[model samples]
Each structure stands twice: as structure tokens, then as C-alpha cells.
Target: MNTLKWIKRILMALLLIIFLLLMAGFVFERISRSIAEKIKPDGQFAEVENHKMHYLQQGKGGPTVVFETAFDPAGHLQWYHIQQNLPKSYTTFSYDRSGILWSERGANPKTGEKMAEELHTLLEKSKAPKPYILVGHSFGGMLTRFFVQKYPKDVAGVILVDSQYPADEKYLSPQLYKMVNQGLPGGFLKFANTFGAARLMFKNMFPENNQYQYQNSVMPALLYKSADATLEEQDHMKSVKTEAAAINTFGSVPLYVITAGDKTKYDSFIKDQKIKNEMLGAWDKMQKDLLNLSTDSKQIIAEKSGHYINQDQPEVIEKAVNDMVEKVSVQ
Candidate 1:
């Protein structure tokens, strides 16, 4: 009888502990989200598509330069340096991707081809110029690559930053590929898109192993916007197919590629010897593949910079871009 009573008490204690932890987590998430909402963009616009797209435009010249921060957590403000110092001759405008940062949600994949089409429509509606230089990072690189193929006559030069093409699916992990591939139709897209669902995912995934306070902004906050561009559930899949089709169409337009350097170089945090070796080996293989892919374009690796190479080595990116512009201009 005494033993049974002790077991019941222990189980009750554990349940109470779990309940307290869940409540604390809920409170912390609310606080973090309230903080990230405060960061502001340099300029803002309600795009012709009826979705708001944030932007920052500066300078003036022959071929206007447009920068796309189509990656996570950022709006138009991520171009802190390029907007400040990309030469006086070129007009530069950096903007948030739809469904990211301050922009209104619009679509999935947000391919360069579809985005380029939208921007072109916006340009026509807003009377924005054409025959401009295009710059993109990561996924944005895929977009720029597609734009050059789709509208070769409209682009003068292109610069792609730390763009992860030719790399295997290992970097993104099979699970993420599964989520993006499976969950779109599995219904996580519609459900987790609201601000509440996003807060839960971002906070829980913060993993006690890594620490980054949501002091300002988080990638998922971009989920607050609605996707007006998607008509059907599979429109997202169509976007993927459309982007793949665009890849089959790369043109001979002036091109520059920036290969990124991963920081497994100084990574002592990796405890397992086998995982460390695998990381180092993977980084070396990616470097070799990048060098081979840089044939027509000027390719340089940004050292110690991981996925967000532009944010890590923006000045290096800026110089490489300017050099490419001068070289292509002379050609």
C-alpha cells in the first residue's frame, strides 16, 4: 500500500513539472514575437498584386540594380551594405520576397520566374524601368537564373550570391525536403501559416543546443501575410515545376557567381569525430563543385560564411558584383 502511494505521488509531480514547462514556453514565445514585430523597413509599398512588398531604392543610372532577399527572416532591409555602397552609377533597389518579411504572403517556391513576372507587372503598373542588373542570394539565385532565361532581353548583368546549386539535398536534410514536399499538400502550409502556429514552431525548434534570442525578427513572422497568388492547392507544386522548367532554359547573358565558404573550418563545437569529418569532407566537395561550376562567371568563395553568405561577407559580394558589371560593360 505504501509503495503504490509513492508511485502515484512521483507521477503527479512529473505531470506538474511538464505542465509548468509548457506554460513557461508559451509565455516566452509571446514575448519573443512581440519584440520581432518592431523592426522597420526603409520603404514600403502595396504591390499591384494587392500584396504589400517592402523595398528600399537608392542611387540612379543606366541599368538599375535590383537585389532580392528571398531567404528567411529578412525583408528589404537585409541589403544594408549593397544599398549603401554599390557604386554611384547604378540605382539599387532591394525588396522583401512575397510571404517573407514585411511583404504580403502570395505564393510558394516564389520562383525567380514567377516573381520576375510579378515584378515586371508591378514595374509596368508602377512604370518601373527595364534592362536592369539583377542580384540574388540563395533561393534568389535560382530566381535570377530563371529571370535571365525567361527575359534575356531585359537584363544587362547578373550576380548570384552563395547560391547553393550543385550541392546535394543533404544540406537541407531529407526531413525538410519531406516537409516542404509532403506537408504542402498534407496541410501544414495552410495551418501553420497563421502567426500563432509560427510562434510555436520557431520557439520549440530553438533547441537548447543552439541559442539565438528572437530579439528582433524571426523568419516565420513572414507567415503572417496571406497568399493571394495561389489559386489551387497544387499551385505551389506548379511553381516548383515552373522553376525547374526555367533551369532548363539558362542563357548566355552576362553572369557572375559567388561561391560560399562554410565554417566547418573553425567548428570545434561538433563533438562526434565522424560527424566532424563528414562535415569537413562535404565542405571540401562543395568547394570543388563550385569551382567547376564557375566557368563562365567570376566565382569566389566567401570564407567562414555559412548559409547567409551575403550577410557574412556583403562587402566582398559588393566588390565582386561591381567588378562583374565593369567587365561585362566592357565586353
Candidate 2:
């Protein structure tokens, strides 16, 4: 009788422990994050094409501007400051492309025209005033050209911020080609995988960067986006990526390319010296390619910045953007 009693007690204790752990995990996984609650982002949400998209809008008037972000989940977040600072002189639209923030998760490789097509639809749907300025940063910058080609009549101007060019592919050293052509995940990705790393990164250790660096609340969206990019549809992207390569190879675009003149911190993650050099080399390509893109184009080198140029130098980008905006007005 005593032996039976001890076994029963032990089993009961084990069961209780299991129950508690389950409850804790459930709480952690299901609970909404604090940051998600912080900003309402004041934009219309839509079930666009294969996925839902969250787009924020502010200001009012001519030159309706649309912002496309780099391939990050919280891409819209990167432009928060710039959006706030720009004179609502023209209405601005910043959206979470496909699998990005607040947007429903879905499969999509996210080609330039496909993305631009969605924006094309978004433009028609929003019924926002016409003559749009399609401004892209990094990958977003590439899309600006793609959008202009697809909707030649619709665009008023374009701004490329320290962005990749149509010819960026030509300069793609074998190493950089593996990184971008393979279309891997963004650099700060690990920051989303761990709580401790996220803490260090979110402390603004990186500028113009959201604190949720390691904690990607938007990954489900990325996975789905990558999964859904159809190969046939990607044919256009091949040309787009190729044009980017050619642009880099020969240099082209009625462009403004901002090069980050800063060096990487060369810590553990930063230890990838080959990667560091390749990225810098590619950065140099922006200047060369833009000159190739347009005779009247200008290249501004931003000092003390990383791949995330606008984050570190928003004022610099804003001034650059304003200059581009004014230049477009002149054109």
C-alpha cells in the first residue's frame, strides 16, 4: 500500500509540472506583443491579390507618393520617421508588402513587377489622386524603375535611396550573387530569432531600426510570400533583376543613388569580412550605375551608415529625396 501511494504522488506531481509548462508556453505564444499595440499606423488594410496588405496614409494633395521597403517584415516601420518629417506637401503611402506587418501571411518570391502590379491595383483601388511618385529604397529602389516601365503614364517622379540598381547584378561578385541572386533573408534576421539578441539590437544599437530586430512578429508573412512567387511570373523578375544587374554593369536610371560611406562593426556577425567588402563594393556600384542610368543623375554618399541607410541618415535621405522630388518637378 505504501509503495502504491508513493508512485501515485509522483505521477500526480509530474502531471502538474507538465500542465504548468504548457500554460506558460501558451501564454507566451498567444499573447499579443506590446509594440504591436503601440502604433495604430493609421492606414487602410486590404486583401490584395494573394495576400492581405496593410498600408498607412497621411498628408493630402498632389504627387501622391508610395513607399516600398526593403525585404524586411517590418519594412514600413523603417520609414516611420521620414514619413513624419516630410511636409504633407504631398500625400504619402507606406504599405506592408504581402507578408509584412499586420498583413495576412501568404505564399508569394515577390518579383518587382508583381509587387508593382499589386501597387498598381492598390493605386486604382485607393483612388488616390494621380501622377504618383514611386520611391523605393534598396530593393524598393529597383521596383521604382519596374513600376515606371509598367505604368509609364502614371508616375510623376521617383527617388532611389542608397538603392540597388538595374545593373546591380553585373557587379554582383560571386559572393554577392550568392547572397542576393539566391535572394536570401535580410541581414538582421537573427535579431528576430532570440529574445536576448533582440534586446541588445532593439536598444537602438542600430539606427532607424525597430527594437523588434530579433523578434520578427512578421515571419509568417515572409514565409508565405517567398513560397508563393510563381516561376512563370518570376520571368519578369528575372529581367528586372537582370536589368538591375545591367544597370549596375553599364549604369542607368534617371537616378539618385546614395552610397553608405560607413564601415561595418566587424563583431561576431559583422565578422563576415567578405560579405562586408562585397556589400561595400555593391554600394560603390550605386554611384557608378546611377551615372550610367542618367547623364543628369546625381550621386550622394552618406557617411557613417550601414545597409539600412535611411535609418541612420533619414535627414540625409530626406534632403536627398526632397532634392529628387524637386528635380522631378523640374523634369
Candidate 3:
């Protein structure tokens, strides 16, 4: 009888300890979120499909340049330096998709077509003049393509900054795809964020790249919606690809494909010599294929950079946009 009572007491003690730890985590998470909200960048909000969408705009007048970002917590910040460097004679805009950064999650399904539509509505409601010169990086490249297909009249030209291609699944090894698709389960990530685990990981992740505004703007988005949105997009990549494949030719849309020339970057992600070689070959083929989409297309290789060319070679991006703007002016 005494032994049984001791076991029961120990179990109860353990449960109480866990309860206290969870409560502490919840409190910490709430405090961190409040702090992040206080320091976020100054940006305007517009209602799209009954949800608040955040955007940053600069400069004035035509032709408006729209920035579409990757599946990153930094949102529009990915294009910050390039956007800031552009001449004020042309207007520029960058935005967080719904459930990203400061934007509220909308009711529509998280598919590229729906997102393309939401972007159109957001542009119209915000009074950002068009036709826009769409600049897309990584996953944003997919969204930009969808936008062009759905609303070709809204876009004057396209600049793909190391964009994601529709046939990526065909080229990427199963191991790499599996690693990307299942890196971390979203439900677990959401649970971790709620209990402050995500915040701790985020702090460790960005320890070396400290900037006041970057931390202020990115941390909240990382804690709030980055995981869920990322997972949803990955889950629906098949549909996104299908939609992307629909529009084979842009019919002289003035496309500019900026490819990262550093093939060695894949060395870190892929260990197998054979698979890595295959991926590199496939990557080069796809980039070349993107050039054929528009008759007036040109390609620029950012030889010094890796995947994030905007970060490594902002000058290249700035020149690309200015060149596109100049081309549009003559048309």
C-alpha cells in the first residue's frame, strides 16, 4: 500500500511540473509576440477578401514595379535593398501574401491561382497603378507567372530572379524532395510556436544577421504564420505546377531570367556526387528553358551569387529592373 502511494505521488509531481513548464512557455510566447508587434516596420494595410493585407510602397509615378517574394518570413524585406536603390522616377511596391508577415489569413484556398487573384484585387484596391513590371524571386516566381496567365493585361514585363520552375519535381532527387517536403511538420511547428520553442529556434537561426528592422519585422511573421503558409504551399506545389505548365509562351512579354551561376551551392544540400551532378544539369536546363517563354527574353547569370541573388548581387537586380522599366517606356 505504501509503495502504491509513493508511485502515485511521483506521477502527480511529474504532471504538475509539466503543467508549470507549459504555462511558462505560453507566457513567454505571448510576451515575445507583443514585443515584436510594437517594433514592426511602418507599412499601410488594405482589406483583401475581408482580411488585412500589409504592403510597402515607395517612389512615385509609372511604370509600377511589383515585387513578389519567396516562401520566407522576411516577406517583402527580401527585396528591400534592390527596391530602395531603384530611381524614384518609377513607383515600386512589395507585399506579404495573406498569412505572411503582417497580413491576416484570408478565406480562399492557398493555391497559386487564388493567390494570383488576391494579388490583382489587392493592387486594384490599393490604387497601385498598372500595368506592373512583375519581379519575382524563388516561389514568388511561380506566383508572378500565374498572375501573368490570369491577368496578362496587368503586367508589362517579368523579371525572374532565380525562380522556381514547374518541372522541379522531375529534376530534384527523391531524397531532396522528401527532405524539403517533410523538414518539419506544420502542426508540430505551430505547437512549438505557441509554446515558445519556435521563438527560441528563430533567435538562434538569425543570431549572426542582426539588424533592428529585420528582427522586428521577421520574428513576428516567423512566429505567427511562416510555418503554416510554407507547408500549405509545399503541399499544393503539384497544383501550382499544373497551373504553371498551362501557359507555355508569354508571347513577347519582355521576360528577363536571372539565374544564379554558382553551381557549387548544391554541394552543401546534396551529398551524393551522382545526384548532385544530375540536379545541376537539370537546373541549368530549366533556366535555359525559361528563356524560351518570351520571344524578347534575355538571361543574366549572377555568377557571384547563390540562390538568393538579391542579397548577394543587389546591383544585378537593380539593373535588371531599370532595364525592364526602360524597355517598357519605349513600348
Candidate 4:
């Protein structure tokens, strides 16, 4: 009789704890949504296929500079510093991908081709004049490459900033590759977003300036809309490589490849210098190969920087884009 009573009491305590957690999660979610609503979007919107796409544009003229964000969910905000420094004579633009901050969730699969098509449409709808100079960072580089391949006539030049090579997986060890490709758990993110846990976690760690406000506003939205889309994009990695292989070259269309200089952190996760060196070598070789993509291409090493060159050395990106703009202007 005593044992039965104790068992019942323990079971009841467990149930109560679970109930409290669920309730707390619900309350946090409500608080997060309210905070998100108070934040204003940084840019204007363009309607594409009846969905609103958010974008920011500065300056005013021909051969518009279009910036694409890295794989990180922050979107156009990643280029905030570099974009601000560009000349006012030439138009510059940046935008969030579908399912990212300030953009409607897209129904189509998040493949490189689909993203490129959507970007093309967004520009057309937004009335961004043609003869564009596409500047892409990281995964955005792949999308920009796809855009150039599909609409070669519209693009005057390309700048890839610490971009992801299509065959990147081939250079990675099997263990590393598996770790890189493994998808984050969407359900956990969704739960965290619902409970405002993600918001609290990132609020303090956000970058300086006005970035904290931006990050706080969009962190939950990204968790809610982008978690699954990110996974879906990962699944299509092979297809991205295949498409890249098919394009082979970019002809003489003025390409600049900016590679990161700091390689000491490459294998920090595993704390293995050998693995890090190998990965860094592969990355350098890949960046060099990017030169083969264009007859007029060159590679610049951001000697003081890492993968996030825009943040580490915004001046480097500024110079590269300025140079590309000058090159296109003459041609």
C-alpha cells in the first residue's frame, strides 16, 4: 500500500511539471509575437506572384549593384555596413530570400534554380533597372552564379565573397560532411520560437548599432518560417553542384573572388590542425578555380578576415564592389 501511494505521488509530480512547461512555452510565445509586431521592416516590398518580397535600395542609376545574403538567416542585414559605404551615384540593392525576414514564405522548393528565378522576378517586379552587377556572399554566391548563368545578358559583372563552392563536400571528410549536412531539428526551433526562447537567447548576442533591434524582431520569424526551408535547401546540395558543373564557365564577364585569409579556425570544432589545414587548402584551391570561371577574373585574399568578410573587413568588400562597378562602367 505504501509503495503504491509513493508511485502515484511521483507520477502526479511529473505530470505537473510537464503541464507547467507547456504553459510557460505558451506565455513566452505570446510575448515574442507581441515584440516582433512592434519592430518595423527596414525596406520596401515588391509583389511577386501575389506574395510580398521585402527589399532595400539605395543610390540611383545604371548597372545596379544587387547584394545577396549569406546562408545565415539575417538576410540583407548582413551587408548593412558595406552597402552604406557604396557610392551614391550607382544604385545598390539587397533583399531577404523567401521564408526569411520580411519576405513571405515561398511555396516552391528552395533550390538554387528556383531562388534564382524568384530573384529575377523580384527585380523585374520591383522595377530595378537591368544591366546589374550581382554581388553574392557565401550561399548567395551560388544563387548569383545561377542567376548569371540563366540571364547572362542582364549581368555585367560578378563578385563572390567567401563563397561556397559547389563541390565543397568532396573536399570535406566523411565525418565532417555528415555533420555539416545534418539538418537542424525544425520542431525544436518552432517550439523555441513559440515560447520566445530563441528571442531571449539571441537578443544579447546581436551585433552592434541598430542590428540588435533587427535581430530581435526577425529571430522568431526566421525560426518559424526558415527552419524547414533551410533543411530543404541542404537536401539539394548535390543538385547545386551538378548545376554549377554544367555552367563550366562565365566567359570574360569580369569576376572577382574574395577568399578569407584567417584559416586557423577552420577545424576549431574538432581541434585538429591537420584536418583544418586540409580543409583550408581545399578552400583555397576552390577559390582559385573560381578564377577559371571567367577570363577577366582575379582572386583577392582578405588577409585579416575569415568567412564573414563583410563583418571582419567591410572595407575589402567595399573596394571589390567599387572596382567591379568601375570595370563594368568602362565595359
Which tens-of-lDDT digit does each residue in 1-331 have in candidate 3?
Answer: 9999999999999999999999999998888777777655557888998998988888888888999988666677677667768898988999888887678887888888899988888888878877899999988987787888888887899999998887666766787556544544668877888888776766533324443356444654455566577667767777887888776787789999999998787877778888778877877888888898899999999998888888778899999999999999899
lDDT of 2: 0.61
Per-model C-alpha lDDT, please? 0.57, 0.61, 0.80, 0.78
Of 1 and 2, the candidate ranking higher by lDDT: 2
Candidate 2 per-residue lDDT, tens place, 236-330, comes to 45566665553331123345667777766323343577787776676576556566555556677778776677666778877866666676666
Per-candidate TM vs. native?
0.67, 0.69, 0.87, 0.89
Worst 10 residues of 1 by lDDT: 207-216
Q: How many backbone clashes does candidate 1 have?
A: 2
lDDT by residue (1-331, candidate 4, tens digit) is 9999999999999999988988897887776666666668878898776778889888888778999987766777777667778898988989888877778876867777888888899888777777899988888887777898889999999999988887767677787667655656656766766666765555543455563465545654455455545555666766876786667688788999999998664655647777667777878887888788899999999998878888788899999998888888997
Q: Best candidate, lDDT-wise?
A: 3
- Encode model 1's per-residue lDDT on 1-331: one tens digit a residue: 9999999999999999977866775665566557757755556565646666666666665566778653344455457555776776766777666655566665434555567776655544443455667777765665665666667787877777765453334443564334333423325544443325544554432223222233123444433442222223235444554554336333456666676676564355556666566655654564444333224655677876765666666778788767766766676
Locate the minimum summed-lDDT window of 10 residues in model 4: 203-212
Candidate 3 accuracy as TM-score = 0.87
Q: Count the backbone clashes (under 3 Å) in each candidate.
A: 2, 30, 0, 0
**Which is better, 1 or 3, measured by lDDT?**
3
Write the candidate numbers in order of decreasing TM-score.
4, 3, 2, 1
Candidate 4 is scored at a TM of 0.89
